[model samples]
Target: MQIISALSEVSDRYPALFVDLWGCVHDGLKPLPGAVEALQAYRAGGGVVILVTNSPRPRAGVAAQIEDIGVPDDAYDNIATSGDSARVAMFDGAVGNKVWHLGPDHDAGFFDPPAILSNPTPIERVPLDQAEGIVCTGPFDPLADPSDLRPQFLAAKTRGLKLLCANPDIVVDRGERREWCAGALAKLYTEMGGESLYFGKPHPPIYDLARRRLAAIKEVSDAGILAIGDGPVTDASGAMGENLDLLFISGGLGAVETGTAPGGDPDPTKLNAYLAQTGVSPTYVIGTLR
Candidate 1:
């Protein structure tokens, strides 16, 4: 399962791909070099590629932000975000009452909350305890990210409220720096006896919806589709649960924890260790799309 091929060779085999946007395609600040070119070539080869991200923003909102960051819309055939799935339940008022905001404004807008916490940082103390549940988008700052709020989340748990993790990625690249994500906070909250609901991949509904969106393509099914991402749990594990082929990158989340140098791809040993833990080894190992 751990094979190395030039990026182009991998593209040749799989005509359709479900690519993770943030870490795999861009770093939330700019597109990775040759990522655009790789996708362009993939498309040029008569392939279809869709970007599937766990960003809590709506697909349109996410796509816009990526475009602003210089990732062309042509990079993928279509896009899906966790917000796209969670909104169905949100609109139905599943959680019913208003949610206390904890992340970014775009994330809050996913619920299209009539009212939002205008203040982004300082992780409001009083009103946060007042809301029905907490929906975490990300840590405002990594140094003081929500990971530092393990105790605070426990206090919220005492009040008997749910925690909805909009973006389930544990970490993401903010340009050259890797920061904590909502899922990492959610995991801590779970360990602290707080309840949570996640609507992102490595989870079933998200992948189901993504595949259904690709039904128009006659030949894309079963072994033909590939899911590419950086994380073991979200990207690799989720794809594993779905019985889909995957491409794992050492350049993204695994870059440092596995002892790889900055801007360099990960080695196969650490990657194998990651897969061994996740129980999902990918078909390909790409340092980057380039």
Candidate 2:
């Protein structure tokens, strides 16, 4: 991967950009340094920016959180989240409405608003065994390990209930810690013989949604779009799935193995091996979004 100091190096090459949220733009609570400005700069240069995220909440909820967390409104043109795609699938009757919510109450925005608004397939959170399906926004406790959800997964599996994983991210960096996400729990459930439906990055539905939005604004062409993100599992895989070019952020999980120099640039040898091990090579790599 070629290390780049500024997105301006290649921002003009793509008319559309699919940007990641959590690790790439912010660390859940605050905007990553210079990340927001990089996005604004890209937009100023005439690129259409769409925020693609694995957030379990709907796009409006995610937008509210980002704004609350100090992300400027002009960073991107539109937003897409796993919850938005999951809601679309649910409304289409691909997944049933009587779902047992597997995450915390803070994620109520994912289901409650739709229920009040009387969406066609408004979701109802029932007890475990009473559920026709499960909507996993995240873990009940972000600080807890995935092992803590084993019993829950086993119980749901034995009942033969399907899971709709709103966030397909295994984990995300919350400043100094790595917190378990819905995808980790869904992986455990699948291993216990339960079926799971994923809605976020590395999945086709979310990408299709973003592509459609991008198409609406300009001539649709995969060759002219670039995917910028931090996770190899989610972002790299998603870009590969859609055959889009990727610009990997090397300061997230990629930084753990590929230690940085004094100036915070990635160690070339380690970064190369990390990408090689994942078998997902990026078109470019940068220490941060800026």
TM-score winner: 2
Cα deviation at 165, candidate 1, in Å, is 0.9
lDDT, model 2, position 252: 76
The segments of candidate 1 whose C-alpha lies over 4 angstroms from its true place after superposition are 113-126, 145-147, 150-152, 216-219, 257-266
> Tens-digit lDDT track for model 2 on 12-31?
88998999998888987789
lDDT of 2 at 172: 91
How well does candidate 1 score on lDDT at residue 213? Answer: 68
Give the alpha carbon lDDT tens digit for every residue of 62-115 in model 1: 878988999887777887778776655455454436567667554556756322
lDDT of 2: 0.85
lDDT of 1: 0.74
Best by lDDT: 2
